[model samples]
Target: MTPVVSLRGVRVAHQGRTVVHAVDLDIQRGSWFGLVGANGSGKTSLLKALAGRLPFSGGACLIGGEDMIADRAGRAEQFGFAPPADRLPDSLRASEMLAFVGGHLDRVRRNLGPLRQALGVDPLLDQWIGNCSAGMKQRLAIAAAFAGGQKLVILDEPFNWLDPVAIFDLRLALRQMVDDGLTLITALHDLHALVVACDDGLILANGKKRIDLSHGMLRDAAVAPSLFEKEMIDILRAGAAE
Candidate 1:
């Protein structure tokens, strides 16, 4: 089967400075792929470029066989992106925000009921976004990402501001979604969560691909998590020193 997401020599730049170097990747349908990197390692920039929210150069980025940059409107329907909580609109009610972004509030609510319940965002739906706490906002942001019933969802630092219980719930929920045929891409800082949730992942260091963690490797890491984490830390530290 063709990959759900494919990138070849992908590069992203900001202010004429390239932050994401030439990179190649492929993610199969129904897989949960993780992006791991330290601060300023280009994870966010790469995610934005893939989602068509940022401009990129040097190669092709195809989502479901279509050019992501050229067919952004179609891509929006295929994937949902939940950026940082601070990017949500403060003035709108959570429900309104979902409707604005996802279109058709009723359909969004019906399609994303499970995710909303899992995220504990139902109570905040009627509340203005400005009044919600960081955790609450984060929950809403996650729910909003799935509001469109997208086949793929990309989350950046989704564990931020979430309590331990919420984190656990989200992990379970995301796993279930993938099992039910959702393609997930997440930029994560929490290695524990990455080991627990992701089937495949790669480490990014200084705008370059540092390590690719395959499914079998991650499965082994799941059994011996600390060893995996140590390996990642050693790599990251080495990358940082360079």
Candidate 2:
């Protein structure tokens, strides 16, 4: 089967500084994939590039085998992207923000009830975005992303302000979403969470691929936490030294 998402020699530069270098990646359909790296290592940049939010300087990215660069709108329609909470607008109410998301595709509006319940966002609908806490906003953003029922979801630093309980719920929700046949790619800081939630992991160091481990290669749940953390820390340390 063709990969749900594919990047070939993808690169991204910001203000003349290349942050992501020639990355080739393939994410299988319905798989949960984690992009792990230290701050500034280009995990977020790569995710944005894959989501077609940023134009790559070279190579190509395809969503469901369609060239993203050539069909920006069509490519965007295939995935729901939620940036970090701080990037979301502060002026809108939760309802307004959700409406904006629904405007993009009718599926979002149609699925509003179930998504709101799943994210525990029903009570937050009337709150002003600026007044909501970080965790609340994160939840709302996540809910809005899935509102559209897009086949692929891309989230950048989703755990930034989530409380412990929210984190726990999010893990279960994400796993359930994947089981329901949607592909997920998230940039996350927690190695343990990644191992628990994702079937595969990709490590980036100084904007380049350092490790790509599939589900079959990862250790069992019992040993994964320690082993994954050690490997990630070693890569970060090596990147810092370079």
Candidate 3:
């Protein structure tokens, strides 16, 4: 089977400075892939490149056996994005935003399923977008991304501001997608959460790609609170020691 997503010699830059090196990644269909790194470590940049949200240098990004940049709409129809750079229109209700995205996406609406039963908008679906909490809005964002018709989803720091139970719910939700043959690439801060939610993860450091850990690796790493805290602290200490 053809890879769902592929990048070859992909490099990204901002204001004429390189942020990502010559990186190549192949994400198989129906797998959950995590993108993890420190702030400004180019996780977001790589996601933007993968999602076709930004331009980069020297690479071919493919979606389901086709070139992404060459067949823009076809590739676009295969993916959805949460927190998609543009902010929500403040005057719209949660439902209204959903309708708008469904309409704007052209051919993607046919793939959407029903919204979550306990949507973050449950208490405020009737309220304006401006009034919701960050967590609530983030949920709505994921809801919009998974709008269902697409086969792939790209989420950047989606767990921000969510409570513990909400985190678990999100994890289950992503797993459901994988079970149903959907592909995912999420950017996350909490290494533990990424280790928990993703079946495989891509670790980016120093504008380079490191280990691409599988689910078994995540399970064996003791990716609980203490190990996570220690790793982060070590990153800090190593920076200081340098």
Model 2 TM-score, all chains together: 0.91
Error at 222, model 2, angstroms: 4.5
Model 1 poorest ten-residue lDDT run:
68-77
Cα deviation in Å at residue 50, candidate 2? 1.7
lDDT of 3 by residue, 59-172 (tens): 677777776654445555677888642376778887778767666433323344323643444465576878877777877787788664567889898878678888776677
Name the weakest run of 10 consecutive residues (lDDT summed) in model 3.
106-115
All candidates: TM-score: 0.95, 0.91, 0.84
What is the number of backbone collisions in each predicted candidate, taken in the order shown? 0, 1, 3
**Model 2 residue 231 lDDT?**
62
Sort the predicted structures by lDDT, highest score first. 1, 2, 3
Worst 10 residues of 2 by lDDT: 105-114
Q: How accurate is candidate 3 locally (lDDT)?
A: 0.71
lDDT of 1 by residue, 35-102 (tens): 99999999999988787788777788888787765555565567788857987888899989988877
Off by over 4 Å in 1: 69-74
Task: RMSD for all candidates, in order, please.
Answer: 1.4, 2.2, 3.5
**Top-scoring candidate (TM-score):** 1
Better by lDDT, candidate 3 or 2: 2
